[model samples]
Target: MSIKPLYRSCDSQGASQRSDELRTYAASLIPTLKARAAETARLGYLPSETIQDLEAGGLFGLTTPRKYGGEPVSTRAFLDIVTELGRGDTSVAWVVTLLNVSTWGAATFFGEEAADEVFGGNQPARVAGVLTPRKAVVKKVDGGFLIEEGLWGFNSGIYHANWDMLSIPIVDADGKVLDYGFAMVPKADVEILNDWNVVAIQGSGSSSVAVKNLFVPDSRVTPLSRSIGGDYPSTHLADESLFRTANMPLAALVLTFPALGNGYAALETFIASLPRRGIQYTGYSKQDEAPVTHLQLGEASAKLDAARALLTSHADALDTWAASGQYMPFDDRAKVRRDVGFAEKLIWEAVDLLASASGGSLAAATNPLTKIWQDARMASLHGFVVPNTNFETYGRILCGKEPGTLFI
Candidate 1:
């Protein structure tokens, strides 16, 4: 299906308008998404209706390159859209966030040929991935590389995508590792394993996938080291600000929005239930009238507010740096990772506070709070968003130390 661009070229005012319009569109789908939340969980993937609604709205291409008829919005705009969707359904937002960001990664890290193959004819190509180069067996071959065999887990959104963006170590003729990079492979070349059952984000359909004896041409493979801090291979780097955004920072930032959405959903659901619920063992008839309940509500609200504030601050920093056509400095980029982990921590706290106040009945599978709590907790555990790890990384950088990892 051909999707039309929402915004062609624009200044700040125009970009802001486009962002507002996209947010409004996403907001309109909340009711439908909310209604389908249970069905999505039961099916362990997004419903076709939900996918169609998103496609018709042009949301899946938010980060697609303009050359391929995509309307690449600013970092802030992308967050706004994803956060709004998360408020409706955590799994749906998570899938959209990963798919869009992976598409952006394809455009930024690869050459013109790769982009043409993925985003050709204005087609909304959904790219899903497990970008960590873990347990991949590869051999350097003539003109390209051959992935002998590998099993990759946590392949989010792969069920609905046409391509998988995988990471592998570049090897020499003697099987010596030279570098680590991403390989763009068609979905048909990989074997999908039906093993996505999990406690949270069930609708994400994050199935495990495998590949064996798959050949990737040189054009579709790019090293991670060169694309770390906006040193990308895409020719559009000079013309497109979105392509110039810091690579790892942008990738890390995309992970936190679904958690942010969970915070909003949990608060709204808990508050709406207050009038109908009571402190089961207490003398207070209505939970909202109790002092303890008030305290919990107030604290959770504050945490949610603080989380949103942190996300906005970092997103603006990314946008500002991209606008200047310069790479975000190492210190600032590390801070983005720190902020993301910290923000997810705050959101998780907020969700936990509300869940605790929800009484014992929340354990029921039918309760929305149950799923929200599980999903938020799961999102917090992601390696990039783990609060203490990111804190240590940022702290080390501040103390004149190396980041200890290549992702930064």
Candidate 2:
């Protein structure tokens, strides 16, 4: 017996309008990704070939600087790629979101030489990251710091990447550690434990990473003096303003795109069912005939649209600041963060609306919407999108008060 798999595609509406040629290539890979999303969920991680496929699509370098064999796609294009991938598969989308955001850090924090080292000055560069601040502190070694830190949830796009960026804390003999710097270790140095098992986004392979007693040289990690993000790495060759946008919002925004895409995919599923599903109690033959169902679809669709706009608005703000070559002002940065938080809320709401309107079938073990709903909400609790903390922190920043949070 043979069954046709569910082949799908991400919305290319945003990508087609963009000038970047790489997006078209990346967008085309959606069906293959969609085919594997369920298997990824079942296996709790994407198999190696999935990573290889993404690499071939050039997704690993989606945000790499143009100078380093990167397409240096536009912010809109990057968002489009992410949202589309998320639409296809939450786990792949998670990998895309985390990996792209981490590489986005490299463009802004590391210098040209560093960029070249990973991207190889000829092929697209892939960087994996673990930013949860799991560090053992780095002391001054003669040439570099002897970093003995193990980062949890390293999100092994490292399986496809050449460089892995682990967060490290600086410490002196007196035990007063100063500054947060990211250590760049070659994939060869890090050990991956296939430990990513949880309620959602199973294919992310967000396993524990052990870097035991491994040494990272000074040139490997860039010293981000403070969370006060601004232009630093100065890859003068990558003069694209999008590549230079404020590091904070870029990293923060990526964390939410998968949720946005998942919500959209869920909505799409509901829409597909409406044309065929018969109402349970009424003689009505179509789910869409019910006013409540129509309202649910309309409300959920509107929320998704709003979420899209807010996320893009944040990206637009970052684009403006980077183009002007000004540090993204704290106030603007805070607002952009608020937008990210709001976007998260919107996606979660969309999921709830769609799931409720979908009826108990959404609760079925074999139904995909249940997975989408579960994944979207669970991922929203991710540190970057926690609305209460993001709202409070951004609100404080907006009110001219000293903001307290390591995130921005």
Best by lDDT: 1
Q: How high is the lDDT of residue 338 in model 1?
A: 90
lDDT by residue for model 2 (343-374), tens: 89989998998888777787687787888888
> What's the alpha carbon RMSD for model 1?
4.1
Off by over 4 Å in 1: 1-11
353-401 per-residue lDDT for model 1 (tens digits): 9998887977898898999999999999999899999999988888998
Against the hidden true structure, what lDDT does model 1 obtain?
A: 0.86
Cα lDDT, model 1, residue 60: 88
lDDT of 2: 0.72
